[model samples]
Target chain A: MTSATRRHVLQYGLAGCLMGLGSKSLGATTSSGVTDSEIVLGMSAAFSGPSRGLGIELYRGASAYFEHVNRQGGIAGRKVVLKTYDDGYQPDPAVKNTLTLMLEDEVFALFGYVGTPTVTRVLPMLKKFQERQIYLFFPFTGAQPQREPPYGPFAFNLRASYRQETAGLVQNFVNIGRRRIAVFYQADAYGRSGWAGVRQALKQYGEQIVGEATYRRGSKFTGVMRDQVEILKASRPDAVICIGAYAACAAFLRDAVDLGLQVPIANVSFVGSENLLNLITQGRDDGERYTALLVNSQVVPSYHDTSIPAVKQYQELMALYAPSAPQELLTESYTPFSHSFVSLEGFLDAKMMVEILGRLGETPERGALEDAVFSITEYDLGIGEAVSFGPERRQGLQKVYYTVVDEGRFVPLHNWQTRFA
Target chain B: MSMPKLFSMPRLFRKTLFGVFFLFGVIGVSTSLLSIYAVDTHLSKEYEANSKGIAKTIADASVNILLNSNLTALQSLIDQFIEIQGVSYIYITSETGEILAHTFVPGIPEEIKAGDVNSTTTVERSLPGMGDFIEVGSPILAGVAGTVRIGMDTGLIALKIQRAIGQQIYLICIIFVVGVFAAIWFVNYAAKPVDGLLNFAVGLAREQSSDGAKSQELLARNDEAGDLARLFLHFSRPTDGHGKGPQSGPDRSKE
Candidate 1:
């Protein structure tokens, strides 16, 4: 052949490769956050702040599940990648980080967002970009906004509402004949949400709160705990339900015990059970009497409860993924896995997300994912109960389990009936 | 032998009388309607403000007591709210819609079901036995706890409106009655010159001198009635000041 004919053949081959690359880019751009070999998700949580345990551990648990799936040849042969930004649990930064995730990173959906304050700020941005159809799945709050109308359409919750948690606590207490109740809450949306739940639950038993006190939203529990303890002590309540974070709750409990007030203090799961226990038992006695009296409502079952299929799976997954947990997490009190309620909740949320995504077939679009979540009805999540959703029901978990700190570890309180009887 | 003009009235007097009555009627009706509208609007706003205020206070006190299982305190709180002037019923409800303490018999209204306490909502409803009342739902601690509902009787608002309307009606009636009397007096005073002119014309037609003095007095005045009287006096006598009267003239007046 002539030299001119060989050159013409090489040019034609180069143009063909260019057309193929262009087509791939067009296909990748058509889907919001899906590519030929990847599905990218975005999250904004407090990865580096005072609340890092919740945000970082929740991310860790979720990433562990995602990594496990990726290693098993990925979901539908496409790797799940989560890009998270540290909002520091503040609303302003949360808004900026969420917008960056939506606009710059161009992620498909928002997953495992933490805090009611942060989520509240993120919602308006979602509303502004509603046509984008960014599904906020399993936010770490039972605040009413995520469960009610307007915002409900955009949010898919995995845990029980604060109302349910407080209701369970109130019901159990009332069953035990503890009629005189008081509330200690942080003065914010999260605290108020749990506070509301306690009220709702008590109302069912034809009872009302005897006293209520509040600490500042982001207080470090130094000076405010005294006032809260004093206020609750004055009420002489049979039990005090605390709607606050681990530090504040731990401080309040410590002060209450120090003041010789021996009433039972209850906390909802949002108190971060492991963190709260760590705070309570950090420098305190190993078998403090207050430790046994402090009860907490857990949205997820006990980390050591291998009887439940989910707990077993969670432990196995944690062992496989998080091989080097912090030293403090391995203390004699609670050693069944890293053992953080927030982490377990995050794992469950990711597990459910994978379940829903797996059900949506190979190529799930944005709207299809949302519709699939709503269509989930009576679907068992292997935690001794089934999660269901409909047009009206957005919350997946309705049952709340109670646990008390004993010997510096959380133990399931399954005998409220016999004890009360 | 000319018959007196049947029911003769001065044209000016008739127009003035009709105009006065029509103007008074428009003013009376407009004033009455405006009074009713103003009274109703003010009363409605006042009742709504009062009802919402009571509902908010009850909600603030309710959540703590509800959670603490203080049924007695909750009951006492509701009782105290019930004593507020227009409050017909007050109730505390769980987030699940259970009523803890309620002054009403049937408990929480169906319109205000559970999960209906997300925000501050108010509705004017008429209960079967409670009569018409404005129902307000305020969430305890921004709806984190539960809801407090207060039903303020529309009876007081209605009564206020009714009393205001009655007073307005009475005032309007007084205005109308006074307006009628004033209009009559004004019309009579305004028509006196016309009456004089009419008598002058009648005397000219009958060739009489009794009404001449009155016509002279009317012509002395400076008004439309005076001008009319002057014209009547001028035509009744003659073009000249001392021309022949109707008795000696060609007697066009008799014809």
Candidate 2:
């Protein structure tokens, strides 16, 4: 070969080799859990544990939306599928399930993770694969840890935080001229988050929690309620804010009534409103009177409120997708999960996800997904108010609404001033 | 009693020593400076990343507190964050430009309160009490609740850089001293053969018989001194009628 020809060949060959190396170092973009005809999302939540009502209802609701979209040929002609793993509401199992979903199943995202502890445990693992841009979207938690830095980048929340719920609850109590407030909390992240929110809220009125009692996380009464009742009775609080699972809170309330510690009680939306009501009314006298003294803070509008577009859509869609499910059902297990606030929230979350994904165009990736979500500015969710986000804002909802049980059904309280008036 | 002249270094030896000093010194100083710069840049980036992370965290925790107008809890959180090393100050302000909770003394500046900090903002400023610092600000509930800002003291980073530079200087000084000793040994070893050639030439000039052995030893050497030794021996020998030199002269054309 001529000298010039050899030189040219070497030059081009070296350049090509260097370019290949550069691309390798930059890493190839491999889209996981996505295909031409389908996009799969992964979820790890309690499906066979004490918190089963919440996880099952939430999943069913979101799935209902997904099914509805699938019937309409899906978003951009790609059918959405959800892959769920039952973690029993424990951190270790949740971690294992998440790893399996991410590494083995290769899911697009960890969508709708259920509990605060489970989400907290999954956060460090999320950081390890930050480059992959695989985020946990719209987890069913309102804990502050996931909403903060180091974990904020990994997860996005759609619901109002526990802080908002607790603040609303506490503010209403204070406005009604109720002092000497006590807290009954479960000993875990979820309970503590609610407690912290209450403490933070009460600080504004120059009041502090007069009494406090605790139970183990996920405890089912199991003799812990009697001691808590005794402590609460001793404090003689005018009102008690309950931060716990539905069963436990119901047991505590029942015990409090038996001990003649007659007082008004408040609970956050995460307490499983339907489940709590079922537990309170089952095999009990004075159920209506006891129900009247209870108040719950909800992040979403009432499920029966058809005046709202989202609520009407939820009801119609529920009728179509979950025809057998009643508006509210209390089964033999005493846990309730049929057409409730939790399910409504899940449905709303799915709607938002679908909207963002559709706007992302076909073959949506992680960066584009984040951009679409963060760029949302006062976008209507078919609910009364609009939801939004920003570069520093990850959560979408802010308002907290209050509800009280009346004649075996939840009815919205008009306003905080009404309680005092 | 005076030191031998052989111990005294020549101009070439001095030049070689100076050259080594300048070259190694430049290399050492440049390497140290580059390393210092690289490490400082890396650390500064890490600090900035951490600052942003902290600011975001505080903002997240502040939302409900701000919404509830719980200045006491917000203040407690700010005070707790200030206890972290390198954190100089933290503050929160409502959306309507009211200072809710803060770690600032004499309250937040009016400009900061009025500033439209929509996203995570970072600024470097010098002020009284806190000499030089990096301030990071983030919104809690944008256009809803409030915003949070944190300040990090730069003195800690500067101290880290200074310590790194001091260590580099210490190591480079040791390398320089060792290099000086090595340069001395090398100069002596190289000049030994040249000195031998000089002695052989001087003996030949005085027509001393003892110079023959010394000149032969010098000629056996394979260095530049051997060539001069051979030339001196040739001129010292008796010339033939044909005006030719000694036939025993070594061939050095290859060299």
lDDT of 1: 0.72
**lDDT, candidate 2, residue B108?**
38
Number of clashes in every candidate structure?
15, 0
Candidate 1 chain A, run of 10 with poorest lDDT? A325-334
lDDT of 2 by residue, A248-274 (tens): 888888788777787778888888888
lDDT of 2 by residue, B122-221 (tens): 8886765446888888877764677777778999889888988888899889988887777777777787787787788888788876446666777777
The 10 consecutive residues of candidate 2 chain A with the worst lDDT sum are A323-332
| Residue B166 alpha-carbon offset, candidate 1, angstroms | 61
User: If scored against the real structure, what TM-score would every candidate get?
Assistant: 0.58, 0.57
- Model 2 interface CAPRI class: incorrect
In candidate 2 the C-alpha lDDT for residue A46 amounts to 74
Candidate-wise lDDT, in order: 0.72, 0.75
Task: Report the lDDT of model 1 for residue A304.
Answer: 85
| Residue A14 alpha-carbon offset, candidate 1, angstroms | 26
